[model samples]
Target: MAQQARAVVTRAAIISGAAAVFQQRGYGSTSLADVCAEAGVTKGALYFHFDSKEALARAIIESQHELSSAIGRDLVASNMRGLNAMIVMTLEIADQLHNNPVVSAGVRLTIEAANFASPVDAPYLDWMKAAEVFLRRGQVEGDITETVEVCSAAHFLISGFTGVQVVSDVLTRREDIQQRLVEMWHMLLPGLVPTDRLADLLTLPERIRASRQAALGQH
Candidate 1:
């Protein structure tokens, strides 16, 4: 039992350390030795936990997806549904990019996925599916416009977010990501929401930010 617990701790530590390195240095530049040094574990320990850096990156991707799924579930359970939930979900992800190294690393690794052998597109597929669900619900609730094709809109949302975060990371290490997301929504909502709904939904970014601050125990 003690050995199992220790193994869990060791694996978690390795993941965290690898995440930090991967976020700081791109996948091609990062080495197993760097991960070992960051993790404060020997090469043998790292090998025991992971066969290669790509394996570590895949693990981080799994963790990132789980985190995103949890956010989706939480917002839905709290009745933050439809368009509002979808918009805030993107902002929340931007927050994770800013604050969570594991998620940040996940984003970087995903962007650099050409280095990997197998497909790394599942996270995106899942995200687009979730976006479709939100858009579909929003349309039924009369918030999203009837002209907006749910499937295309979902794909656009994910692609736009991907580009936005990549740009923001280059510009400000995602320090300005939430505001950028708000800006993206500003342009996007005119097309997606009814004219009357626009005014109310425009305030979502600030509301979500305030909620985030409160949750984080910030003033």
Candidate 2:
């Protein structure tokens, strides 16, 4: 049991090391030797756990999702839904992109997924699926317009966020992502929410930030 625990720790270390390398060198340029050096593991040890660089990249992407899903899981437990859930999820993701190296690397690897013969797309699909669910619930709750097509809106919102973050990463290294997300919601919410509801949701981002700060301070 002790040995198995050590093996688990070693595997996590390797994944984290590879993520750091991938973040800096990107997928095409990163090599197994570099990963081994970064991870402080021998080739034999790495091979015991993973056969190829693609496997390691996939693991990194999976790790990133695990982090985000933990946040989503908590929100789910709280029964949060609709635009409130979507806004909080996106805000949390933006914070992760700015603060977490593994997540940042995961996004970078995902973008460079063409390097892999078959890219892992389950994470993206899963997020879009969740968005669809939230949008449908929003319509039922009267937070979303009946005229909106839930599936199409879900897809566009997910893709639009991708573009927003990618542009933020390029232009500001994501320093301004929170503000950018606020701008995004401002432009998009009017079409989704009732005119009466628009004013309240417009300030949701700021309220969410303040709530987080208060929660942290209490701890």
Candidate 3:
């Protein structure tokens, strides 16, 4: 049992270290040697867990998707209204992109996937589906207008958020991503939300930030 636990810890360390390297260098520019040095692991140890750089990148991407999907699922299970949940989920993802090395690397690799031998599309598809569910529910509950097409709205939200993060990353290293996301919602909500609900929904981004800070303080 101890051996297994140690292996798990080692593997996690390798992944975390590789994520940081990948985040810095990107996929094509990164090498197994770079990962080894970053991880402070011998080549043999890295090979025992990941056969190649692509495998390591894929694992990081999958881990990122899992983290994001879990956030969306948890929000869905909560008592918050669907539109509010969607707002919070977007903010949560922005938070990850800003602070989580693994998620940041995964997103970078996924964007540059065509340069690699194997690319996974499921993560993008899964995220869109998750967002679509929230949008559909919001429309049904009248938190969003019936005129809004759920799938289109989902695509727009994801694409816009992705673009905003990329711009923020380049300009400010994502230091202002949370604020940029709030600004994005302000521009988008006018189309999706009723006038009466817009004021309430527009406040969600700040609330999400404050709530996260409070939770961190408690911990």
lDDT of 3 by residue, 189-219 (tens): 8899878888887777677777876897897
Backbone-clash count (model 3): 0
| Shift of residue 219 alpha carbon in model 2, Å | 5.1
Q: Quickly count the clashes in candidate 2.
A: 0
Candidate with top lDDT is 1
Residues 89-170, candidate 2: write the lDDT tens digits. Answer: 8888888988899999998888889768887776677778878878887888888988998888888888888889999999
Q: Give the TM-score of candidate 1.
A: 0.93
lDDT of each: 0.87, 0.86, 0.86
- What candidate 1 gets wrong by more than 4 Å, as runs, is 214-219
lDDT of 1 by residue, 1-219 (tens): 999999999999999999999988889999999999999999999999888878889999899888877777787666666988898789888878888889989888988997689978987888888899889888889989988999999999999999999999999988788888888888898889989988998777677777877888853
- After superposition, candidate 2 runs with Cα above 4 Å error: 217-219
Decide which is better by lDDT, 1 or 3. Answer: 1
Give the distance in Å from residue 89's predicted Cα in candidate 1 to where it truly belongs.
0.4
